[model samples]
Target: MSPPSQFSSLPKDLEWLILARVPKRLYPILACVSKNLLSLVRSPEIHKTRSSLGKDSVYICFMHKNDDGVGHTSHWFTLRRTKNNPSTEENQLVSVDDLTFPDHAEPMPSIIACGPEIFFISGSYVPSSTVWIFDSRTDEFRRGPSMNVEHSFKCVGLVGSKIYVVGGYRNDKIHQAESFDLKTQTWELTPSPDEERLAFSTANVSLDRKVCGFMYLAAITICYDPRDGSCEVFDLPKDRWWETGVCVMDNVLYVYYARLGLMWYDTELGLWRVVNGLDDMKKVRSVAMGEYYGKMAFLWEDSACVGCAMKEVWCRMIGLVRSEEGGIVGNAEPAQLMGSVPSGYRLQHCLSVSE
Candidate 1:
C-alpha cells in the first residue's frame, strides 16, 4: 500500500490555508514531499489564495551583455530569506537557475511581467511578430500569440489584461500599434498615433488605464487611450528628457533621473514631484527601477566601464508611502551589492514578477 498522506488528518480547506501561509520559496521543498503537494503548489487556486491574503512574492529578472560582448543574456533572481537567520526577514538575490530564456536575435526584447508571467516582445533589425512568455511558477517558456503587425525597435505597455505594442519600423514605415489580450489569447490592432510620434518613441508605460509612449529626443509624450482609441500629445519638462529608467508602481509612474534623483509624476498636478527622503542618495551612472511587492526595486551600476571587464551591480528596496500633503515619500534601505556582470553589460531592463 502507498504511504499515508502527510496532510491526511487536516481538512482540505485547512491544508490550503496552511500552505498559503508558507513562504513561496519553501513551496519547492513542500512539493517534493508528496505528489499531492506538488499539484497543490502549482495550482491556480493556491496562488489566488496567497494573492488575496497579500502574500505575493516578487522575483527580479534582468538582461545584460554576454561575457564576450557579442550578444545579450537574461538572468532571473529573487530575494530569498537568509537561511542562517530565519528569525529576521533579511533577504538576498539568489539566482533562479531553473528558469531560462530562449535564444533570440533581438539584443533586448521589450519585457513586462504580469503576475507570474513575463512577456518578451520581438524587436530586431528584421521585423517579426513573435512573442515568448516565461512563466515563473512553472519555470517554463511558451510562445504567445504574435502581434498583427511586424515591428522592429518597438515599445510595449501593459494595461489591465492587454499588452500594447507600439512604435516600430516595418517596410520602411512606422508600424501601427497592436495589443495582445491575455484573457482571450489573441492580438488586435490598436489605433495608430501620428507616424512621426510613433517612430521616435523610446519607451512606453501604462498610466491611468492608458498607454503613454515617451520620445525623449523630441521631448514629446503620446498618450493613447485603448478604451476610446484617442491619442493626445504633450511636451515633457526640459530636464526630464531621459526616461529610460521609468517604472509604474500602484498606478503611479516613477522615473530615476541621474541628475535629479528619484521623482514621481503627479497626475493631478501634471508635473513631476520629488520623492522625498532620497535626497541623500548618491547618483549612479545607470539605473533601472521595478515594482517590488508595493516597494521599488532599484538596481544600478556605479562604474561607467566599457568592454569585457567585470563590474558590480547594486540594489536597494525603497518603500513608498503617501503623505497627507498629497505627495509621495520613499523610505530606502542601504544599498546592497546584488551581483557582478561584465562591464559591457548594461542593465537593459528590470521587472518584478509576483507568484
Candidate 2:
C-alpha cells in the first residue's frame, strides 16, 4: 500500500486554504502528492480564493538585451514581497522563472492576456507571422496559428475570445486588419481602417475590460476597438511622436507626453487633460506603464551620460482620484529602484500579471 498521506486526512476546505497559499511554481509538486490534492491545485476555486483574499502574486514580463546588444531574451520575474522586511507590502523582483519564450522573440514582443493565458504575437524584428500562447496555470508554451501578414511595431487587441492585429510594416498594399480565433486556431481578415497606416507605437486598454489598441499615426492617436470595428482619433500635443509612453487604467488612457509630463484621455467624453502629479518624470528615459495591484504603475530608467550607459531603473505606483469638479488627478508614491541593467541590456517592456 502507498505511504500514508499528510494532506489526505485534512478537510477539503482546509486543504484549499493551505494549497492556495503555495507559490504557483510549486504546483507541480503539490499535484504529485495525491489525486485529490491535484484536483484542488487545478481547480478554478483555488485561484478564485487566492484572488479574493488578496494573495495573488504579481508577475512582470519583460526582455533583456544580450551582451552584444544585438539580440534579445524574454523572461518572467515575480515581484514578491520581501521576507526580511515583511512589515510593508513592498514588492521586489526575484530571479527569472523556468518559463521559456519563443526563440529570438523581438526586443519588443506584442502580447495580450486572455483569461489565464498570454498570447505573444510577433515582434518588431521577428520575420515569421507566428504566435505563441503561454498557459500560466501549466507554465507551458505552445505555438499558435500564424497570421496572414507579417507585422512589426503593430498593435494587438483582445476582444471576447479573439485577437485582433492592426497596422504594421508589410509588403502587401492591402493594409487590412487581421484577427485570430482562439477556439478555431484560424485567421481571418477584418474590416480595414480608412487610413493605410505604416506603424503604431503602443496598444492599451480603453473601457470596461475591453482592449483598445492605440497607435500614433502622423500627429494623431488612433484608438481602434476590435469588437465593434470602431476607431477614434485624438490629436497629440507634442512633436516627440516616438518618445511617448501610453497605458490604460480604470477605463482612462494615460499618455506620457515626452518631456511634458503625463496626459490622460477620456475615450467616452473625448477630452484630454494634463495629469496633476508626475510632472517631474520629464527627465526619465525608457518609460513604460501598466496596471499593477489596482493602481497605475510605471517603470523607467534614469537619464545616463555618455560614459555611464547603465542607469538604475525605478518603478512607481500612482493612484488616480476623481475631483468633485469631474477632473481626474493622479497621486504617486515613492519610486522604488528595480535594479540596474548593463550598458548592452535595455528595459524593453514591463507588464503586471496577477496569478
Report the CA-based lDDT of candidate 2 relative to the real structure: 0.64
lDDT of 2 by residue, 1-355 (tens): 2232766677777777777667554565667777877787766567545644545444555566676868667656555455575335475766556556665545566777654577888756544487888776677889888889777767677655578787676565534678888779799987765544324546545454334544455556665665455666667665464332677655576777566677787656777787876665545656677665446676776746666867666778777877787778787888888776655454544445545
Q: After TM-score superposition, what is the CA distance of residue 193 in candidate 2 from its true location, in Å? A: 2.1
Per-model TM-score on C-alpha atoms: 0.76, 0.70
Tens-digit lDDT track of model 1 for 119-185: 8787765677888998877778998887887887766788777888877876667767788887899
Candidate 1 Cα misplacement greater than 4 A, ranges? 1-71, 83-88, 97-100, 240-244, 304-308
Best by TM-score: 1
Whole-model Cα lDDT of every candidate shown, in order: 0.71, 0.64
Model 2's TM-score against the true structure = 0.70
Each candidate: how many clashes? Answer: 0, 0
Per-residue error (Å), model 2, residue 352: 2.9
